[model samples]
Target: MTEANGTTELPKTCKAGVVVNEGPDFTVAVEDVPVPTPGPNDLLIKLNATGICYSDIHYMLNDLPMGSMSSYGVRSPGHEGAGVVVALGSNVTTWKVGDRAGIKPVYDCCFACELCWSGRESYCDAAPQIGLNFPGSYQQYVLSPARYTQRIPDGVDDFVAGPIMCSGSTIYCSLKEAGLRAGSWAVFPGAGGGVGHMGVQIAKAMGMRVVGIDGGEEKRELCMKLGCEAFVDFTKVEDVAAEVVRICDGKGAHGVFVTASSAPAYASAPGMLRISGKIMCIGIPPIGTAFAGADPLLLIGKNLTFSGTKVGSLLDTARALEFAARGQLKPIYEVFPVAKLPEAVAKLRSGKVAGRLVVDFNA
Candidate 1:
């Protein structure tokens, strides 16, 4: 295949990080697996790096109540992928064999759906997640739909390209949904987390005065280094909500971006909203739970808007990549070998990781 393609030879078996004893006892182990063949309109990507997201932990542990990876016949879990295309299907034309591409949260959507037509394909009801519904980027080789796979720009390296596949781009969409103008105070509840940190940088880039909410000195330093105008350490504050209210001229901030999954973060979010302010819900709670700011009366009284957004569309992802290429949005991640995926996932599950964790398939 290398002689035919003038590049990497196709290997019958490739190394992959496979999940074992999924659900609370989940573990990832590197093993040799059969390389997949690309279907029509698909591209076989030899992934150089993949980003580890907390959602991968939920899928591995069955933390979300709805569905399990086993139920979908999925063993490897990952969505953030950055690599080069080694093979293409018969019908592919838009991409070359060696083009750089990245995987995203949503793998493919039904193009015929109303949501897909309306430019909201991320929320398409029939959308299949890359890692959850299919074999994801945990392996050295993975397949992505040719049209859906994002093209990585020339200037962005794999380390930065991988996280933008999901976190950076998703938060970019959320900051746009926030609709806050320049100089408005916008607070990120989990500013030290991957998505929250992305929000902080993009929000600041958008000319908004940013405040970051997190737990300790490490996170505070990280937030401050990311250009957050103010940092609120929730552990030391008597009342984080009151502190935010105090910081924003006693009327609360103009916007609050909730990127933490903690119940307390959701509970105290409304208290940080000013009159007519917005709270962009970017986190997911455990199954069967509701956000604490779901009170109709509070929204009515404050005339506030509460909205939820999922990941970004393909166009949004491309634009977000431009942001990274231009150095406007930067990613902070700790890279590890694919063999250390279980450890990375454990660290992320422990909630102690300050930023994103990425795995190099060849490291």
Candidate 2:
């Protein structure tokens, strides 16, 4: 019950997020919209903070699959969010007013699907993605299925917890896919960005040595500070693969998480893995893009495996938040007011952001 600017009104007809039309020219802008109501088994949340994810940019750029907007009648594009539940429907008993909740990537899934039944709901063929398919958390208030939302513990702040809903969980799930045990070496290509930074900490927490590869001296320093054993400035390194091998004692990393969607990262991965090393792809490459420079023969020769992971399931997201509450995971973020989202998105597009950019709705 933190007061917003010391006000109690809570602004019923408050400002909300809207993406005006879709396509390559889609634009996200704020508009005065009605506050939502909770439906059966749903909860209405007053968002305190939400992170600007790469997929938000990708969706805005027409680089991902956005569900039919004609059915929903609005363009609300956000998922990585942390807020307080304000209202709940009749069937929702596990949560109540003022409970902390996270609206993540996997908004809902058909429980009848085989993948959902097996606890791998993240891969459910009929999964519904918030921001892509349904209304999401960029607005002042959002309605989320109570069962799909993860609880945020008391001590974790909303601004820091928001990004975990998507970027943090995605990287955590990708690292899980790598199947590296303690003492293994894991490389993160975009080690200073939102997901990559989280990957660095998650790997380190699991007792793995991490080599962070990214651009700029500051990013290198940042990665090293975030528990990466070594930092390579890919922008300055002449041979990225050679540097990775050099850092791994002339063999190669045991696992590499490609958190950067750039072509070169994927192109250099096969050469950066040790024999039988796994490569986990977490980035959303541009639409219609393929894994460049990766050959089937090379995979067969080295006994290498490649896996692409999306964001995690509701259960996985809950585990991720629990890890954060226990101090095993953290998200580096730059907070801004909701009015400044366009500027934040602009900085994100220009690669000026040092970490995850979060919007503070209460600011």
For TM-score, the strongest prediction is 1
lDDT (10s digit) by residue, model 1, range 1-363: 121286657889988877899887888888889998889888999999999888888788887865888989888889999999999888888988889999998999998988998778999988899889899888889999998889999999999999999898888888887788999999999999989998899888889999999999999999999999899999999899999998888889999999998888988999898999998888777765656565789889999888888889998888889988999888899999877877888788899989799998887
Using Cα atoms with residue i matched to residue i, what is each candidate's TM-score against the true structure? 0.96, 0.93
Question: What would the per-residue lDDT of candidate 2 be over residues 1-363, giving only the tens digit for each residue?
Answer: 322333444556766667665666767788878876678888888889999987877766766555544356657678888989877787888887878888898887789978988778988877777877777778878888887788887778898789989987887777776789999999998889989998898899989999999999878888988898998888788999899998898999999899888888888988998899888888778866757447888889888988888898766676677778888887888888988877777788777666699999888
- Candidate 2 has what TM-score? 0.93
Please give the lDDT score at residue 14 for candidate 2: 60
Tell me which residue pairs clash in candidate 1. Answer: none
Worst 10 residues of 1 by lDDT: 1-10
